[model samples]
Target chain A: MRRVIKNLISALVALMFVNAAHAAGELHIFNWGDYTNPDLIAKFEQMYDVKVTITDYDSNETALSKVRPGGHGFDIAVPTSSHIPIWIEEGLLMQTNPNEMPNFVHVAEQWRNPDWEPGRNYSVPWTWGSTGISVNTAMYGGEINTSELFFSPPDELHGRINIVPEMNDVMNMAIMYEGGQPCTTDKEVLMRVRDTVMAAKENWKSIDYGTKEKLVSGDVAVSMNWNGYSKRAREENPDIAFGYPKQGYPLWMDNVAVLADAKNVENAKLFQNFLMDPENAAMISAFAQYANGIAGSEAYMPADLASAPEIAIPAELQSAGVFVPPCPPEAQQLYTAIWTEVQK
Target chain B: MAETENTSSVLAAQSHQVAIEASRRNKIRNFRLLSMPALIVLTIGAAGPLLIMLVYSFLKAAPYGGVVWEPSIDGWFGVFLKKDIFDGTISIATAHLSILWRSVNLSIQSTLLALILGFPTAYFIATRSVQTRNLWLFLITIPFWTNLLIRTFAIMQVIRDQGIINNFLIGWGLIESPIEMLYTDFAIMLGMTYVYLPLMVLPLYASIEKLDFRLVEAAYDLYATRLRVLWRIIIPLVRPGIVAGSILVFVPSLGAYVTPRVLGGGKHLMLGNLIELQFGQGRNWPLGAALSIFLLCVVMGALLIYVRVAQRGTTEHV
Candidate 1:
């Protein structure tokens, strides 16, 4: 009986060690809904011989809140640039060691050290896009520069425009159109954006997020939208025209960041490296129609897209684009207050 | 004779005792079984989140992401301060209150419309044979099986400029450009009426089914006119059904999000939409919680008003 008991105890200890070894291969990714190509996860799973679980959030704010609550059972997350600084400040993000990502060298030099994450220590640039007005050129006489199509369209088409419900996009567009700096922590700029938005509230047909399909279906004439959506819109109907105001276009980047308390750090790092591969980055960019940070992704892009004026970032237009940083609590509150009032 | 009387009495008493004990045991067993799942569902689904929201609403908004645990009434107070009507503060613009008011208005309007449209049809079905009634009820329910989101989108397609109605009109040369029918108040009304119509019909049908048609016949025999019969006798008979159906349609309509969001084209930001925003983009859980609490109050207030009116009417009849 003593011999049998001793054997059983030793066997149980051995089994527990085996279970710990088996747990390292699993990874959980939480990202924006419909943001990733379906084949990417399958490919990652095949490459690493690990299981991947994916979840989705509609906004950066939603993701942040979920992560702040000890995380929503996710190992990897893709947050927009605006929330990266805040996530870092809150100690929610883990600074990934560059040595772990062998493919990190393939990212574009310009996108490598964005202002949002100074050292590119915390985030991997997944896709970059400019927020602009995507319109049906045939319906609207000509290409328009000002964001006024959203706020102050033709009286006949007053309620026929769709604007993004996102705070920063709407607020920044308002300020930028008024010839003010985009995303100022200054109180005067915020108040001006608020007043401008409030004045045009009645003209807005809809304030939508994640409703790009509605735009493509001709539900709204002109929609304040992202570049990827505009690309798809034009692909579906060739007449769709995307315009970035000469004033400036609010540029955004979605970056993959491993969580601070991620259970599968090794697997997360592996997945991040997998995403950084030029071929894989090209696949995601083509499928998602968003610009990738990969140095060679442009060569793999479709011919029309490769030569597309909007996709081709010119030096002159580069200065017109601005990156929004994670805002302070007071600034967020002020924006929310203005938005709620405008809607009312 | 004495033996026969004793035996009969004993058997009757024993049978009664056995039945009572069997029922008692069955009741306890069923209660124990049912209470476990009921408690679990309530704890997980409703009570737990409600308790959390109650806690979070009093706490400060997280500087970066969530709410701080330290309790403060700032969120609730934020719901009350009157600011420039355009400010997002719950207190200043009072959007939550406005949403609540609009929800009540739309709910009442749609409920009344459903009652009007559903009552006659339900009464017709109820007066028919059971086979016919079931067939009609089944027909009424066929639409509900489809996804509500699909139905809403379909409604949009039917009313949009490139939709069938507009295409037919333009083809016939009835008008010029396709009239904007998609994102108007009319579209919202039509969507609400469609979504809640079946709800109105089912309850009204059940109520009218149990109503005695003889009562109306008897009134007619006593020389009461058809209008008088319907107004005084028929309606009174199905009062409970009306109450039940009204509650069913009104409650859901008041909290409706998708239909208004889609059909109304975000123009009609209802209570549900506002609550969704607060919990979502607005990232103001305290305000969201307060709004939720305010909606709950409105619902309770409505129920109270309905019960009072119903009670008063009942007393008058008595």
Candidate 2:
């Protein structure tokens, strides 16, 4: 009886060792919440015979704070274009080897050499969307297309508008509304933008991040939201509509990059290549309700999404879309200060 | 013979003293041994992070994020001043100071409101029969079982424009349009009061339950009015609970982040929200750490004053 018990204990210990070795082959992914398709993750795991672990963040700042500290154990992260430069400057990101990622050819030409990372050395374009107005036309009784309504709404719409909580996006929209450059660091121009925003603050219902749900529920008549979120909102409520401000709006792009201290660097690269495949990229765009940057991915996307102008910005209106650039440290500080004041 | 007796008595007294001292030392050693685990956990968990935050508050902010190891007082200056990078000039700013004042004002308002609502409820529960008191106490804690975020969101659903309250009012011809109730300061206070009311109630309940009912009856029998009896008898006995409950509610309310962010519409920026922004989008960790330390000092100062007052009160009573 004692020999039997000893053999059982040894077998259990040996099994645990094998499991530990298998767990060592896992991949860790950090991205926006509900941003990727689980089916794609499952397929990738099956294809590579590796286990995948996923974590989600709500904002780019949260992701940056996690990855900025070396050895956060995240093998891959998805950060916005503006944050990519900071990641590179801080040595938090690893340079991509295009030779190993042959599927890079399928990326759109515009994203091939983004101005932020000129040669696409450290980041791969994942998704792109515009920041614009999502209006409940049934509540507003008409299409609310211009930035003027947001900054200075009519009596009926007063105290019925919600703005994004993000400072850069809202400030950029205010600048565009005033016909100034979005990235202008001139104090005089920024002060004018600040005054405009302060004036608009009176009419705002709330400055919150959950604009999509607010619009759908009619808690807010108008909201500044990302294109994809607005698209999803419209699906839930037909009265909800997305409009690109005639005055121009900010364009946001998120990119996937391998962390510098990634334990599973090879697996991270492999997952990136797998995501670049046209069908898989289409699946992501369909699930996320956002446009993927892969060149041929639209061919595999659902017809409704492929035809939806909000999901894919119309070629003509694309000219009005401006890619937000990283601000200088001083300007960033000033923006934060102004945001604090506006909140007050 | 007298000298020898005196010497032996002195010697015996000295040995007895030594034996007592040894036992006292042994008692202290055992006490420390019993508390060692808690002390170590507190040091590692609380004191260690607080020390790190103190160090970071004195350092410079790295451009991308986090802190630089170099010593600098710029973060401290930035808290109360704005620097123009163009000409290297600094100007005094009252914006951050006003936010701090606002947070304290809101915290005090909420704490007082919680006390007003909680005392009566706690007193009523304490006066009930044991079985009923248990049921009422259980009901009071039911809200706590749900996550705070979900509860705040639920509050939004009730107070929003198309929410139940507005709809009911409109349907009953009480109003023509929805009353703006969700994003105002009123809503924030309501949320804070709702969240922290239980904190106030529990302490008050514990104090009220232990009160000598005979004293109240005797005061009433002496021709004291009901209100006078409460004022003279109940209030004096429950002073400690009031102090405890106020501190419990006030401290957390001062550092409230989500309630204000969700219900206040992020319009009224609290100290907690400002500190959070400094770390998140502002990418100014040094400033965030400095603000945090400032808040900590205020709380610690309040706690110390309370402790001293409490000790003095006890000594006077003795």
Residue-level lDDT of model 1, residues B1-318, one tens digit each, is 999999999999999999999999999999999899988998999988888788888888777646778888877776666444234343344665676677788888888999999999899999898888889999999999999999988887888878989989999999898988776666776788888899999999999999998888999999999899998898888888899889888988888888888877776578888888777767677877877777777788999999789878867765
Per-residue lDDT value at A314 in model 1: 63
Q: Rate the local accuracy (lDDT) of all candidates.
A: 0.80, 0.86
User: Model 2 segments beyond 4 Å from truth?
Assistant: A1-24, A141-143, B1-14, B83-92, B304-318
Per-residue lDDT for B240 in model 1? 82
Q: Pairs clashing in candidate 1? A: A337-B88, A341-B86, A341-B87, B81-B91, B83-B92
Candidate 2 CAPRI-style tier: medium
Number of the top-ranking candidate, with DockQ as the measure: 2
* Model 1 lDDT at residue B64: 64
**TM-score to native of every candidate shown:** 0.88, 0.92
Candidate 1 lDDT over A261-308, as tens digits, reads: 999988888888888888788777877788888898777767676556
